[model samples]
Target: MVLTADSYRVLRGWVNGLGYSLDARLIPYLELAGFGSATLTQTFDLQYDLISALVERWRPETHTFHLPCGECTITLEDVALHFGLPIDGDVITGVSVIAEPAVLCYSLLGASPDDTDSTFSKLKFTWLKANFQHLSVNATEEESVCPARVYIMHIIRGVLMPNLNNNKVHLQYLPLLADLHNVRSYSWGSAVLAMLYHELCRTTKPDAVDLGGCLVLLQLWALYRIPFLASVSHQPYVFLLVNRWSIYPGIGRLYTVLIYRLMIEQHTEEGFIWMSYRRPEIAAIIPSSSYVDSQLWCTNAPIISFNIVEWYHGDRVLQQFGYIQYIPDLPMPVGDVHGINKRGKHGQHWRVTHQIFVAVWENRMA
Candidate 1:
């Protein structure tokens, strides 16, 4: 559906309500990225990029099943089981409700008994189909796009904290979301936004905030099938702060450099900045010798090597340092240790190992 004037107004209102400024340069970047004009599509595209970046892809291991007729696929059933839940029904069936994976996602996270077929829900279904259609499995193919895991920590830090200004809401979801292994297959962004509406909007002043408006914008983006890019072409720093850095230590260093760059650009005084793992305790449980040449204190505590970068004003040099944190005892098996242990048969005695890097700056004022 085309973005009407009314829809644009609602979308704009939500963006403003969320305390996120539509970066002035975003429109030009969208045009450069070949997204047509500065229309609803572009707006939706930006939101999509932010949401996609925040959520981790669900890449589940699949096994092929050969049937008498043909080949069938075995996929996770968690999403289907959770879709449009609490509304009595064996299976989801309705004119509006389709069996598409994305539709199921919207239903699980966005749909409710009262507003099952809301405007936003319909729009989100269309967008999900359009955006991910390329990854859809063919009747003959055994491969399928697995459901994604919601990075609850990212959502709280990136989206809700900036707007809600309350940690209580974030605290409530922390326990449920922290247990990554058991999280449901649904849209994290939609779930959090829905909770925001229920917790703050419904019970308190309705007009106090535009939480509903924000949800509508998210739904519209999903409906329009827009592409999301987390970073602007000129701003690589945007990429570092938002995207996952666990895989790239170099990118992590670059992120540290970017923070310095911003400080240098502004000619600000020396100050301290740092980044750490979302769950350091998880690292504590795993054996350290299983992965790399890292120092280990004991089997109980995992030593995490943290890459540190330092910089000084007026000098384009970055001093590098290494810092380590001994995470206390939290015993937990990390799969078959043989695969991770590099010491061969003797490696069986070793524990699973993991490392994290943190960027820090210290400024002394005289």
Candidate 2:
């Protein structure tokens, strides 16, 4: 797609609608790094730089990732050992394993942006194609049910939380456009962004908020097809970010509240679909009604429909924390809503059940 200045604004607004912002410090770093930067600049090369950073930092592992690849049998411990990286009490060092390749991809430019058939795009296409095929196969055959959910969640997670943690075995790389600008500082940011993005955009059974933190890593083969603007460039476009410590979009304890609010809205809705697989107890506490659905679909939530004015209007609670205003309340359905069937291993199932009490109060009527 021709991502123009206007389109960029729309994308930014979409993110802003969800209460996120581009880190001010990041743009300057882009300039300093020799990569040109602009608020609405349209250069696929620049775009590719961001995507490459993400693909580069990619460390393939099965468990330890919020978005685990069910198809892969390798555990996080296995991945660390395979990479010959030190695992200190579940933590991994040497980010260079991911950073170097990202930096290299950040610099490339010169190919025609219209070449949708370029090598990079081809890779992305192939990855997506394979994923689509897998999904189709799993849907057709119940035998692949477990593996299908695992792989599908992995792709969803890659889109959701694409960052690595400080720990060796922990999944990192929350995929955010801004995080992709600077690999080192924003890896976690990116990972969180991935989860947040998918949570906001993709909805099925549960309300968007409960699924907010969910994510999975798509295997490297699954990612090779997607193309970014930077693949055409031959130079690393300098990127920048200030105060790496600050989570620019302001995701923190407060952000967690956003997720809490969403669960409340979904649970109370009529015939609302709740996911009981991973955590049935928590799902049960959502306060079911006949209006809710027993099945969930990957659909967007209605809470996001709130007008900025209606969302921010005269609401003192949100006004107190100015940043809170940035996050708009997702609109709830006017009528029937579907709930999801929960699935996962016994251990995972109980883990979610144990957390029901925490979410139970969330549905209390004022």
Candidate 3:
């Protein structure tokens, strides 16, 4: 039987495979903001077929894969160990559309770009790259902070929390970066996973042509969890597990979309290393900070980013955490929550708009 358009998984790589280089002066600030472990020096293909296959297996209602072996997922532990990012603390939510985009940009970044397309709330990566690309060693502390913030903003828009805009990023996160000293406290890793989980759910809609929101993390998660799909050799483990495949030779283009779907559908529990992170060497590299909230990795809570809320049902995939893989109860009914987006949400703070989900996260482990 041939596949119809309705049954076919459309493949689309990141439309803009852009790269950015951070200035030496901004390193400390980025480190302070909890993204120092991540690097942007390399640009990567999204491994579209691989991502599409995973998305195809993703169950939106359950937020875990219904693979042949058993239910598994990219856990909060994976987000923490992979990126060395803070997983618990302040929620990264705010008004989706800033009422005064120029004011926020100038106040936080010390400059503003031209509002040519009325997309003022969404700044183009080109404008940011052109202006804040470089910072001098002699720059003042105040002078250095501006470019450093811009660099993190680029990471969010370009890499960590990408969206369909491809070349631009929403300014909702600017307020979060306004106070750099407090930035690291904002669970950047959890936010990345939330954005990714939502994207994985959306892509399963059968008509999604483009995938967004940290496809890199999704690919890396697949490589570690589904060893059969990966074709790389043993190498020294990297700190931010996200950086492990920076120099990887491609394994995606070797197979077609249907072939990849078949490989995943045929996987067995024996082929899966449920304890990949338990390796002593890898466990050693996971920073202590990532463990402060290690307990929350298994909490059935909502992982949230501004204007985006996705359920993180750690209780459902306990086997990934090395616990017994019991058959889970009926997956939580969150189909309505999955339908919500940032559209028509001007002047609304995500905390207020999405408080229902946020409350679930607030009382996590209750």
> Clashes per prediction?
7, 84, 1
**C-alpha lDDT of residue 334 in model 1:** 26
lDDT of each: 0.24, 0.23, 0.74
Indicate the worst ten consecutive residues by lDDT in candidate 2. 303-312
Clash pairs for candidate 3? 82-241
- Model number with the top lDDT: 3
Q: What TM value does model 3 have?
A: 0.87
* Residue-level lDDT tens digits of model 3 in 1-366: 554445545567554443555666778888888878765424665667677777878888878887887778888888777677888886788776777788778788888896454447788888888888877658899989888887777777777777778788778878888878899878788898888888888877766888887887888888887777775323323113324322443322323455567767776456777878777877787767766778887787777887777877888888778788666666666556565876776767778877888787777767
Comparison by TM-score, 2 against 3, better one: 3
Cα error, residue 281 of model 2, in Å, equals 40
- Of models 2 and 3, which has the larger lDDT? 3
- Compared with the true structure, what per-residue lDDT tens digits does model 1 show for residues 164-266? 3322112222333322333332222222322322322221322332332133233332222111111232376555553565365444433433433343233
Return the lDDT, model 2, position 354: 25
RMSD, model 3, all Cα superposed? 6.1
TM-score pick, better of 1 and 3: 3
Among these predictions, the greatest TM-score belongs to: 3
RMSD versus native structure for model 1: 25.0
What lDDT tens digits, residue by residue, belong to model 2 across residues 283-312? 354333311221111111111100100011
> Cα RMSD to native, each candidate?
25.0, 24.1, 6.1
